[model samples]
Target: MSEPWTLHPDRALPADPTVRGIAREVYAATRDLSIVSMHGHVPVEWFAQDSSFGDPAQLFVVPDHYLTRMLVSQGETLPRLGVGSTETEAVEQDPREIWRRFCAGWQHFRGTPTRYWLEHAFVEIFGVTQRPSAATADAIYDQVAARIESPEFRPRALLDTFRIEVIATTDPAWASLEDHTRLAKDGYGDRVLPTFRPDPLLHVDRTTWREEIDLLGRAADVEIGSYETYLAALRVQRQRFVEAGARATDHGHLAADTTPLDDLEARRVFDAALAGAVTAAEAEAFSGHMLFQMAAMSTEDGLVMQLHPGVLRNHATAPFAAFGPDKGYDIPVVTEFTRSLRPILDAFGHHPAFRMIAFTVDEDVYSRELAPLAGVYPALRLGAPWWFLDAPDAMRRFRESATETAGFSNMSGFVDDTRAFCSIPARHDLARRVDAGYLARLVAEHRLDLDEATETAVDLAYRLPLAAYPAPR
Candidate 1:
């Protein structure tokens, strides 16, 4: 209100000057800290291909489910957000128009995490001094569009500008890690590495299951026709990810269940699934068994495990078939982590080498399930808020709920699981501001000293993620 487009005084904190001052100091200390992104859904090809980004919408809106979900919530629809529909010809295929629609519905994101992120993007990246709305859409768009074309906004340059020390990209078992190889050879060092995500191989319900399984068999030189060989192939792939500088494996399951089964029963289930003679329940059970097996392997190899459950992925089968997965249709469901993860915990929860990070869409589990688990288990660490829960509000909720039990040390810090390279800075900046705000409150309430609060902020922003999911030396 005071200026054409000034950032909110408390954009990342409460609107109290005293608290804001302390937050600013805490944020400053951690602003330039090394970014260690331990998890994300980014395609490995971007780094592998080492290509420049295309356009504004393609780089930002098209790939981000957050933007599309909000647009759809306001009734703009995904097709208008560049989501390809069955009858793609009849859709509003114009990016400019889509951008305008996005600009018009900007109010929907107000007071939400998205708005804070977008405003940081507008101000810090594009040098925009105005909010995104009908009055300034074209101007805002053009400014950002022009800057992205400049040499400074190039991917590698942006990576440097953003102070990114290390970034992990999720790769399926089949990936060759050629880009990661290139990055290291090009003296990029440990800046960009691969994270092994075995979801495609784990979820037997996927249509590409057989093909991926076959590919895994060939990659591992094993007869994956049997369940024994399938597990062997996974071990081989784990080694490959480790060699490529990965110290973590990510599993996105329907639930956190881990059922440890013996040879005969496991073989029977796998054979049934492989031969298409299995029921849905059998496949789920087999998947659960494999989770424990994976953890056992993790104990052997020292690869940290991250389980992000409670997403009913692509619930609308028709939309998934037409538009592909992660198109803003997936919704969070209530999950039971304590009951689901019991079998695995019973087996390897005491193992010194096995480290597991718990991520949940079910916020209710934070106090009831996550905290108590992380509090007691030396092998377990609370994963940073992920997927639908990675916003400022969600981060705040997590800190308030989990800190009492898990504390700052028991949790991994921020992870910029993003594909839009420009958004990297914007996202991390928002996290720092929010963390600073949180710390400032503790200081204001006389619950913490400024020095200790500042130290915790730095750890939350930098050191914790590094220690939680360190890349192999």
Candidate 2:
């Protein structure tokens, strides 16, 4: 059996002591940098309520698609983990059993960052001293449960303790952001912010789309009938989010494609899309037009726009039918960002206020498309390699391929991008370690100096995210 370790020097530091010294120093320089989260799917209400967390299984397994997907991939049932409905229907009240099963299979995660992050979370958050297993599950659970019930473990306390300078949560555009507004009204700290994501507005065929669009119109106080009126309503909502303390807008699309259309043709296409009978060509055209308009709106309103395109959502139809949207079944299909994004880039690639962060399901395009695109365009920056590829190995691959072309400045710093709240510290710590390791390799090979590595590491861990996203006014 591979022995459990907290943080072995050999794993993250360079093998050679000289280079490892440099690595250790670089890690130290950035280790305490305040977290600046500009994009993520964490529930906004967490900050609104500022409640205490539950036990480990509910905190880790129930909310994270990353964790649940791995378990499901290994023939472990999601319901057994108490994530979705299927595993919960027959058996009831087995949170401890779920944690026990996860603990027993914890060895399956050996050497994976999930194991590292979970171990780190255990030590740092709950003060657990041993490896997780069926034998240790109940003890760890009771300990963590006790801590989470304490005032120090409440979400707000943890946020302050973690030294998170600013954290942004994604909310659907139709959402009133009343939670965020309420937080502001109560004179809570400005560290919690909202991101306006317009993904639901992208899929017109869903029954929920029309209702949501109408709700957005109501929120923005505009008519929803014509193309012009609909655009005005969306503009109004964007401004409202800004006034309510939004500094960014998020777009989750099937692709990064965008376009600008002439007035009549755009109106006709919009009419078709609004009626929910859009042809494939019309759907693409309308979405493309909306992307361009959203870019223009960003210029007008100063909200940084983020384009996280190319996810094949809910890849398993059966599970989707059985449970719901995010049950860990969504898979990344290969995506194209070159031709797909050419339309938008051709128009606003150099615009000053139209900032963008592009993510991909396709790592193959990192050098050929995204890096080159980000290298030249003042408006564009690369989002961290995401979803399945957010693993340590994949992160290293991203640095090796993209940094040569795009350089570190053209990349946004890491976003935990997690729904599981407790995992935030664990995830960010993993990124820092992984990034330091990558820099150590450069120093070992004589490609860069230790000072350059130190500055780059600090930027990657903290400062760059603030610079890339809007920083207040």
Candidate 3:
């Protein structure tokens, strides 16, 4: 039989003896720092309800696209994993069976960040000793299922256990924020905050845009008939989010364009969209204009703007239709930020109240565009490597690329951007380890003193995030 899998204490540290020694010390200093997740996709309801997770499969396999997408890649069906299934399609009802399938395919996750996180949760969080395999699938599932039934495994309880100082949940602009209100009442309001996402409101071409517009109007208690009222509704909702303890607004667009149109042209496009006569070109232009408007609002309201563009969302239409959005079909595209965001940056780049963290999957722009932009602009900060680039090597490459130009302070530290609640600490842990390794190399090279490298590591792990996204006063 194969030996049981075990995580190394110095995992993800530099391989060189000199650098590794420095890395070990650096990693130890920030290993237990309080996690500051300023941007993420965790559901606010999870904290408000403080409910126990259903089972091992429900907690791991079903909801995580990172797990399910890999399973789908290796000849598995979504329904079999307890994901979205049509009425005609048969769905797997047994959580045990789903867990078994996940465990059986354990080897498929080798060399993936998902693999590292799952192992961390298994060994550190759940006390699983045996490595997952077809033979051990049932036993591991029972162990995980039993562990999740404990009160400590519940959402809010896990917050303290994970040492999460602050975690922001992404919520739609039209959201009522009733759950956030409940959390505020429960004294978790400051710890678990909301992030306003206005993608639906900006994209006039979407099929649900009209419905979302009406919902926004009702939620903001505003009468929306024209572009002016639409802006008013968005402003009202943003204020509501701020009142609910939101410190930032999140935007994800296909591109980072922020050119604004004249009032008449903007009104014309809005009227056309309202009349269901807007062309695709017109809609795209309107979306860009809305982004500029969002920036202007951010300057006024002090909500830090976070823009992560350059994704061709729902690349595989078939999977999107079957499983709905965020089922792991979003593919990265070559994103241009310098020319595309001139309008917004030129307007608010030096504004004292304006702040924006720019994120990208396109590493090509790290040194060439984003780093240089952030290095100079007081309002702009380079977001940490995100999505596909959140892995170990990619993260190292990001620091090597951006730190030279943008420097440590100009970076937004690390944003987990995760939907998996349990994976939060694991992701932050990976980031902290990677940053320590990078700083260790600098120390080994004599470019930075040992004390300087340690301070920078602590800043990256804690202080930078707090400074980047300040809580609403």
The per-residue C-alpha lDDT of model 1 at residue 374 equals 88
How would you encode candidate 2's per-residue C-alpha lDDT over 196-215 as one tens digit per residue? Answer: 88877765655577888888
Each candidate's root-mean-square deviation in Å? 2.0, 2.3, 1.0
Which lDDT tens digits does candidate 1 get at residues 178-214?
8788878877647777888888887676678899988
Sort the candidates on TM-score, descending order.
3, 1, 2
State which candidate has the highest lDDT. Answer: 3
TM-score of 3: 0.98
Best by TM-score: 3
Per-model TM values vs. the true structure: 0.94, 0.94, 0.98
- Give, for candidate 3, the lowest lDDT window spanning 10 residues: 82-91
**Candidate-wise lDDT, in order:** 0.80, 0.79, 0.93
C-alpha displacement of 164 in model 2, angstroms?
0.8
In candidate 3, the residue pairs with backbone N, CA or C atoms under 3 Å apart (3 or more residues apart, or in different chains) clash, namely none
Of 2 and 3, which scores higher on TM-score? Answer: 3
